[model samples]
Target: MKIGELARRTGLSASRIRFYEASGLIEARRLGNGYRDYPEDAVQRLEVITCGQQAGFSLEEMRALTLEPTGGANRHERLLASLKGKVVEIEAMQARLAQSRTHLLALIAGIEGKPVDISCEENAQRLLARLRENDEPHSQAT
Candidate 1:
């Protein structure tokens, strides 16, 4: 099939398909008439690339997984290691996000809990003081 047909089949733009080819993610053969010809399996390959991208895999990472020929024995082990590493990274990010949410909630509570009689300027100053205090390192009790 032609590049246009492949693009239509993959629901990707022609330029994106060409870019993938340029990025070494997929290949096309040139016909004598200078038209690009793609194998039927290219559709499946494009789907894999799309899925990998949606799963947060970088182009280079996708290329490694899809294009690189791993010896039959270690392929499973390598894939497992990569997936485990991604899980760990995602967990660490989740931890940081949770901490951030906690901190923001605390700040919101502090702002809302301020006495009604206090002026906005006074509340701002109090919030600044609280932020600065949080920034300071606390001494650990032995």
Candidate 2:
């Protein structure tokens, strides 16, 4: 079918389909009239590409999975290994985000606990001091 039909069937824009083609994710044949002709299997391939993208697979990774020769034996194992690695990376990112949240909450608490009796400039100075203290490296008592 034509690119327009393929776009409608895949629920993707024609430009996106064209991008996938240019990215080497999909293939199309040029007819005698210079119009692109796509095979029926292209629809399923596009679906797989979409699913991979949703799973956080980069275009390079997707290309590796979809285009590499796997010897037809360990494809599932490879995919599982890749997924496990991604989980570990995501967990590390979550840990950093949690630390960031804790630090932000502490800063907010410090700001809110400032003495109301002090001038605004004094309060600001105290906050700056608190931030500087937090930025300093404390020596652990061994």
- In candidate 2, what are the lDDT values of residues 55-93, reduced to their tens digit? 778888888788766466588888778788778978998
What total of clashing residue pairs does each candidate reach?
0, 0
Error of 2 at 125 (Å): 6.4
Judged by whole-model lDDT over C-alpha atoms, candidate 2 comes out at 0.86
lDDT of 1 by residue, 26-80 (tens): 8999999999999998999899889878866789888878886846757777777
Q: List the RMSD of every prediction in angstroms.
A: 2.5, 2.8
Instruction: Give candidate 1's error at residue 114 in angstroms.
Output: 2.7
lDDT of each: 0.86, 0.86
Q: Runs in model 2 with CA error above 4 Å?
A: 117-139
TM-score of each: 0.80, 0.79
Model 1 regions lying over 4 Å from their true place: 117-122, 128-139
How far is 53's C-alpha from truth in model 2 (Å)? 1.5
